[model samples]
Target: MRTTHALVQLALALMSAPQERHWGYELSKTSGVRSGAMYPRLRQMLDEGWLVDGWETSEEAGGRPARRYYRLTEDGQRELGALLRRAESDSRFGGLDLRMA
Candidate 1:
C-alpha cells in the first residue's frame, strides 16, 4: 500500500494548488512521479469515483488542445481526511511528521 499512500499524498499536494485545473504533466512533476506511474494512479482514482477529469481547448500553447484538468471528489476529500487520521495514529510514520496538511 506504499504506492497507494504516495498516490494519496500526490492528490493532497495537488489539492493545494492555487489553480483549479491541473495538467497531467504538472501533476507528475510536482508529485515526483513519472507519467507512467501517475496516469495509472489517476485512472484508478477516477474509477473509484474519487476524482473528476475533463479536457479543455488551449490556444496559448498551440493548436492542439491539452487534455486538461482533474479535481478531487467529495468522497476523495473524506478519504484523505480518514487516511491522514489513520497515519497520525499509526506508529509507522514515526509519529514525528504524520500531521496532515
Candidate 2:
C-alpha cells in the first residue's frame, strides 16, 4: 500500500491494539483521521488483504445496528511493522517513532 500520513496514523492505531478488534469510529478517533480520509484508506487496506473484517451481531452490539470490525491478518502485521519502520526512517515522515508490539 502507498504510504501516507493518515495511513501511517491508522497503522499505528491498529498496531497499538494488535490483538483487539477495531471499528470505524474508534479508528477515526484513535488515528485522528477524519472519516472522509479514513474510510477510503480502510477500503484500500481491505482490498489489499491487509485486513479482515466481520460484522458484530446486533446481540453482541447490545442490540444496536451491526457494526463492522477489522483486524490485521498475519501478513498484515508483518507488512505494517515493516511499513512503520520504513516510515520511521524516511525523513519525509518527520521522525516518526515506531515501536510496534
Candidate 2, 44: how far from true, in Å?
1.0
Assess candidate 2 and give its TM-score to the true structure: 0.91
What stretches of model 2 exceed 4 Å from their correct place? none
Which predicted model would earn the best TM-score? 2
Per-candidate TM equals 0.70, 0.91
RMSD in order of candidates: 3.3, 1.3
Instruction: Tell me the tens digit of each residue's lDDT in model 1 across 1-101.
Output: 24354665566565565246678887877766778778888788788887789877676457776676888788866765666666665666442343445
Measured by TM-score, how close is model 1 to the native structure? 0.70
lDDT of each: 0.67, 0.88
* Candidate 1: clashing pairs of residues: none
Residue-level error in angstroms, candidate 1, position 1: 7.7
Deviation from native of the Cα of residue 9 in model 2, angstroms: 0.3
